[model samples]
Target: MISMNCFELFIQTYFTQLQVLDISRACAGEYINGFRWEQLISTSIQHLRIFALQISFKTNDPLMRENTIQQFQSPFWQEKQWFFICSSYSIMFDSYINLYSINPYRKKYYLLGNENTTEIDSMPFVVQLDIQCENV
Candidate 1:
């Protein structure tokens, strides 16, 4: 499992020469705010054209949930055309909020969970879409 700091370092260290980046496995409890914590991305990954990352955080705080979407509303990421979507799901005791990019560098697979989800941009070629919902 890679921490957010490690992901940041990975990008800073190697993304300069890469064009696309994707992290398949979920990053446990790593919260990312593009507005407050992504200055390094625009500057560091000069050659990065597409970035696909999924970050998860365990929380039920409304502010944290809102920030998951609010933080990515900045032009800092939009201008680069890197967009993301935030999802909030409550599975029993734990509430998991995930933030992931929807960049169109490859085949698109979008998943919408049972809880609330917010997306910054839309993907045209959605090969797969999954939605899960259950009454609590």
Candidate 2:
């Protein structure tokens, strides 16, 4: 299991030559913030052109989640033609929101409301992006 800093370091250290990247996973805090990702990409991966990722953020606060998702609407994302499709649902005490890039390598399949159901063939790593959430 890689910590957030370690994951960032891995990308910074080894993926500097990276032209494309595709990742999907549950995330929180800074990982869910688009501005932080923009900063990281700007400072670390100079050659990065195609970035496809689905960052799922879970919280009890809907307003905070909405605000966080707004960070992706900036020019840094738009100028790169990095549009996104977001999906949300509530599971017991937590509200889950997924922000995924809609690009050429964009995700086409989504599995919501069940985090434990991972054996499906449509999982994102091979198919591209998997935005999963817990059951409502």
Candidate 3:
């Protein structure tokens, strides 16, 4: 298992090189324990997409998921884009399946709620962005 500091270093060093990073099979315990939202906003990579699946281990209580969702929906991140996918099983486990994206000139956010009952698929949950950039 990668230590928290190492994970932070890895993200800092490598996230810029990646256009998309998928960690669908990995558990959330490692990430939630070490991840700070502030750290993500500070990355040098101005554009990236992160897909995390089966990561509900952070939501131990009924309110936890809602709180996290609230943070995701917060307008404070008007410059960033985020997507979320919460599985029924993960709702019980408190693991979250979500995506984070960053772009300087455009933003998109998607929310997948508790309505879908399909079994988790091997395909990584992804949000396709159709951005039309305009020159400033």
Q: Whose TM-score is greatest here?
A: 2
Candidate 1, 1-136: lDDT as tens digits: 4456765675455334545555444444443656534665566655555667666767868677677787787877778777888888998887888888774455343445445456425432332333333322
- lDDT, candidates in the order shown: 0.59, 0.65, 0.41
Q: Model 3, residue 23: displacement in angstroms? A: 1.8
Clashes of 1: 0
Ranking, TM-score, top scorer first: 2, 1, 3
Scored against the true structure, residue 103 in model 3 reaches a CA lDDT of 30
For each candidate, how many residue pairs have backbone atoms clashing (under 3 Å)? 0, 2, 7
RMSD of 1: 11.0
* Candidate 3 off by > 4 Å: 1-4, 26-35, 49-54, 76-78, 87-136
On lDDT, who's better, 2 or 3? Answer: 2
Candidates' TM-scores?
0.63, 0.70, 0.46
Worst 10 residues of 2 by lDDT: 122-131
Which regions of candidate 1 are displaced past 4 Å? 28-31, 107-136
Q: Candidate 3 has what TM-score? A: 0.46
- Once model 1 is optimally superposed onto the true structure by TM-score, how far is the C-alpha of residue 101 displaced, in angstroms? 1.9
* Model 1: how far residue 133 lies from native, Å: 27
